[model samples]
Target: MRILLAYDGSPAAETALGLAISRYGDDELVALYVAEVDPTTYDASAFGGGTDDVPDSDEAEAVLEEARERAVQEGYELETAVEQGSPSDVIAEYADEHGFDQIVMGTHGRQSISEVIVGSTAEQVVRNSPVPVLTVR
Candidate 1:
């Protein structure tokens, strides 16, 4: 089971990792950290953690390191990447490109008009993915 765990260092994403680990065991997991930086745009602010306190590159690196450590502690043979693009597109493309058996991700739990407008990483991935996607909230 080549499981791709979409990690953002968020609480919900952590839950997704936990679920994947518990369900599929550590040996099958791959940890993925996407920077989601809009490559065409020169502005870095449009992507990354979206916090002024942390620079985009540094923040993404930190999150990747944290996820790697955690996955290692669980005994998974983990792989990582920091990509620049739309989150949903990157995730789906990576899964397709690498031939992952399943994709695990977190949903932000936004509802109503806000969710409809802002959209969601989980939603798009589930919709556009060529493989199976497990959404955790």
Candidate 2:
């Protein structure tokens, strides 16, 4: 079985990655980070200024890099992808196109009010995914 792990370096996402490794270490593992490009905007700051030390672009790349290194250390050959698109759509499409047996992701655990306004990516993926989706809190 192949597992597709959606990683963004959030604590929850890191937990999901760990769960995937622990449960399906013997299977094929693919880690993906969607860059979440906003087609309407070009200002980099739009993606930053959230109290994170690094810029969003740098942080995204850093997280992917760290995940690759961790995978290597864990003795698994990880297929990683950095893509430009909406997170839910990109993740679901990639998993389907690649024939992944399962999809693993982490949720920010947003409450009803925020979810109603912005919608949760995990919720969207779970709803639209072709395969089983495991969401780590």
lDDT of 1 by residue, 30-54 (tens): 7676665535655655445343323
lDDT agreement of model 2 with the native: 0.79
Ten-residue segment with the worst summed lDDT in candidate 1? 46-55
TM-score of each: 0.78, 0.78
lDDT of 1 at 33: 69
Clash count of each predicted structure: 0, 0
Whole-model lDDT values for every prediction: 0.75, 0.79
Kindly list the per-residue Cα lDDT of model 2 for residues 1-137, writing each as its tens digit: 99999988888888898888888888998888777655566444665633232236566678878887887788766777676557888899999999999999898632355456878989999999999999998
lDDT of 2 at 2: 91
